[model samples]
Target: MSSDALAELSAQLPGDALLVGADAVEAYRRDRALDPTAGVPLAVALPRTTAEVQAVVRWAAAHGIPIVPRGAGTGLSGGASAVDGGIVLSTERMRDLRIDRTTRTATVQPGLLNAELKAAAAAEGLWYPPDPASYEICSIGGNIATNAGGLCCVKYGVTVDYVLGLEVVLADGRALRLGGPLIKDVAGLSLTKLFVGSEGTLGVITEITLRLLPAAPAPRIVAAWFASIEAAAAAIAEISTTIRPSLLEYMDRTCIDAVEDLLGRGLDRDAAALVLGGSDDLDPDGRDVAFMIDAFRRHGACEVAETGRAEGEALAAARRAAIPAVERRGRLLLSDVGVPLPRLGDLIAGVDAISRDREVTIAMLAHAGDGNTHPLVVFDPTDAVAAERAELAYGEIMSLAISLGGTISGEHGVGRMKRPWLREQIGDDALEIAERIKLALDPDGILNPGAIFEAR
Candidate 1:
């Protein structure tokens, strides 16, 4: 934490691997969450290899400095937020990747962008299916850290489903390799799965081994506009139970309005909800597409239509741009709360009620097929009253999801922003066991001190 200690650490690392100046380190201090309390770090370490990461971790352990492991800093949760007098160990410079066509896997460095990985896989006639909304900017390592899910995850699965192995540096700077390319390796504990969504409390992930699949057919999309959110929810529930969908998404009025404002894409500004259903299978009967259209109509959708892959991709891009579009309106306190499919309607209704009571604009969107939702609460920071209400609405939404027998976070990890409510969701016993595991791996508690767990 001191200049002398930083100097010593710098000497141990390769030249140009550390950044100490205030100006150079400012950008690494916070993630997309922009947690106002994000701290100024002692220095930002950019390690390119596992050995460099080990050196940095050893120095941090020696100094008892907290190390916040970061990827592309595209996290909506404050998982990578820096600690005061801590070291922000960024993997941005570790951009090495290899594709094994024989094994149909990708062994990649932590810093590789998800899009880059997808492109690489595609070149080899393979595909990495976990496509988060921010895939273009987010890192594959961060995806593994949070077990990220995307639009297609309803069928393709999340980041953890594709992660076959990882190379991680422990708190004491020792590297451990878990799992491998073999599809049926049950040799020991399911350790690889454990670290997939651990955020960064246990250790720093330097590299990942991902499972890939033969590229899927381009999907056709079904767009439906509803007169009521309840109707849309009912349609989503029915569609989810009846058939397998590549993607099933919902955007409430506020989200649609925001995106429309940003893109002017002819979205129905007056519609109560918009549901996008998709399928990649080239069914001769177009059964799934017809079923979705029928469900939409059955649930009183005002308009329903099927579109080809070209149009579907455009709509998906708009969906991906929702968060940033909403951000343009005001400060956003994003909530990744989810409930059972049967209770999806109830969750949205409860959120609506909370918004009315809090008097805040809550833009709701979801990967409806999987029951995960992101309720974006927008408010002006300078308006103290509005800001306070937004905070209340955010917590209330999570509580609502928990009450409905759901999770506080479906894909986004329990970063510091969501930590206070994590215990509420997982219960005391599960949390206690998790804490014990953290202690076992990070005894000094120097690895991401305030991420998923408090510093021990």
Candidate 2:
């Protein structure tokens, strides 16, 4: 992009909304992935309203400059990484929200943080269930862009489930409304769902309409430590088949050790794995918790603890802290893969085997009930050999997931990091269709270039 084009674009936007200097644009170049190859953008546009977003989109479309939409910069994949000579369109300033009790819906701008939305909903006796590990730091827009999933997703759902509508700015700068507050609307095509997880490939999401529910009943938790990794995987499989736990999570030896090292929480450092379960139902029948405990015992749990409210929360907090704690160990390549519920054991075991064979410190954790796992590969950037091994191990894990009839990406979108493997999972016909759609919507190839599909 030329300097004159940058100046013209900056002038079109509101005061101070455009940051073009090198130092000011540094933070906008990468998300949590910290992609070493991330490029310095031509500018960083922080738009506070849909109009400002339209202005930026117009400028980009006219100049044919790529625009990457950013939320709270908490994405694990390089979905928000800047393209060379492009602009990073950030939604951090677009923080506006309105909650409707009668409709049980919240109309919010893209910039709101997930935890902020949750707190706002909670104050109105409602709940927004999608809670990623980085819930407090991740933006609602990024969550929607990635179709993020979290612990409660086993019983509740992911970001796409709650998104009823969106206001997206197209490549040509036209603002389009996809859906609305109505719960069931088959007015046209399922365009709303299509946009939910597009990962900013097609357009810029400026506003969102979220569906809500009555606050969930406080959950009772069950914690189990296993003598062997197989035993923990077995417990998870058994429970998934027998009961629908509100939250079913697993952390292997590496994860437990990482968290323990950081928190000094007295986690079983020698245990092969740890499984956490939760039940949110106000059941007079009392089936969920009992079923989980029984499954744990049947699958060879070394020890089990069913706890009160406070103790249960402490355990959940530890699970949420796993990603950040493990990050302290080294740089990471995070994989979010999912297999069939029945094959959960095989998936976990396969990942363990990959770690050993590759000689990489692969810390594994999961939302077990949904068969979704996040295998974090830790490597020292200074050690070239170890980093190469970690990269190989990362691809191997995805290949393993595919062999077992699992997806390469479960909730996290196939951002730039995972783009190469996407065709391996989806095959040529599907990829072709996806590419055609991308061309149709973003003809200029300006929105999040090199994200899902590469620039032609």
Candidate 3:
């Protein structure tokens, strides 16, 4: 991009919204993945409002500069990776939010953090269900961009399910509001849904309308440790077949050890797998807790423990901390592959095989009931041989998931890192259709280039 054009665009946005120096822009180059091949952008634009965002997009479009829409930069995938000589359009300053209690919706800017939105909803006796592990740091806009899922999503649904409306600035700098607070409107194509998981390829989302539900009841927790991974997988499958718990999570011995190492918690390091089940049913006598306890014991649980509210939350907190805890082991290549409910055990077994074959340390964790797993590949950057193997194992895990009639990515979008295998999972015809739609919305190919699809 020409410096003249960037200077003009910089002048239009607020002083706090522009980062042009090399040092400042360096921090925006990559998200959680820390992609070594990420490029250096010409500038990073932090727009505080929709109009400022439109100004930056319009300027970038006129100059034919690619724009990467970024949120809190907490993405595990390289969805927010900067492009060479391009402009990074960050939503960090667009943190405005308003809660409409009567409509049961929250009108928010994309820059707001997921936890911030949840806390605001809670103050009004409402709830936002999609609680990604990084919810505390990840932005609501980033969550929607990736269609994020969490433990609660097994029963409450993913980010797309909560989204009601969006105000997006198209590639041509035209801002359009697709839907509203009225939930049942079948007015036209589901454009709002289209943007939820678009990964910023089509347009830059400035505002979103999210549906909220009444607060869930305090959960009763059930914890179980199994002797083998197969037994734990069988228990998860059986539990899914029976009742739908509010939260169902799994962590292998590797992950349990990592968390224990960091937190000094009394995690069962000898167990092959740990399963946690939570129920927020209205029944005061705790029928859901009783059911889960029975389910775990019947499915060969080595040990089962049921607890009241405080202990239950403590266990859930540990589960949520699994990612960061595991990160301390080494640099991580996290996989979010998912499979059919019946093939959940097969998928886990397949990953285990890959781990052993590649001779790499792979820590496994999952929202087990939903069949979504995060298999973290840990490797040292300085060890060339191990790094190469880790990279190969990363692709192999996705390949294994696809072979099992599953997705290469379940919650995370097919960002730059996973784009290579996207075509193999979704055939040419489906890819063609997606490209057509992307072209129609972003003919100039200025928004978040190299994300889901290649730049036109």
> Per model, how many backbone clashes are there?
0, 0, 0
| Tens-digit lDDT track of model 2 for 1-456 | 677878887787777899988999998999888878788899899999888999999998888888999999988888999988899999999999999999999999999999999999999999999999888888899999999999999999899999999999998999999888989999889999889889999889999999999999999899999989889988888888877889999998889999998888888998989999999988977689988988899888989989889878887888999999999999999989999998988988898899899999999999999999999999998999999999999999888888899998888888888888888899999999999999999987899988889766
Off by over 4 Å in 2: none
Better of 1 and 3 by TM-score: 1
Q: Model 1, residue 149: displacement in angstroms?
A: 0.4
Local accuracy of candidate 3 as per-residue lDDT tens digits, 47-163: 888899899988988889899999999888899999998999889988999999999999999999999999999999999999998889999999999999988999999999988
TM-scores for all predictions? 0.99, 0.99, 0.98
Q: Give the alpha carbon lDDT tens digit for every residue of 338-451 in model 1.
A: 898899999999999999999999999999999999999999999999999999999998889999999988998889899989889999999999999999999889989889
> In model 3, what is the error at residue 160, expressed in angstroms?
0.9
lDDT of each: 0.92, 0.91, 0.90
Ranked by TM-score, top first: 1, 2, 3
Model 1 gets an lDDT of 0.92
By lDDT, the candidates rank as 1, 2, 3
Candidate 2 residue 192 Cα shift, in angstroms, is: 0.5
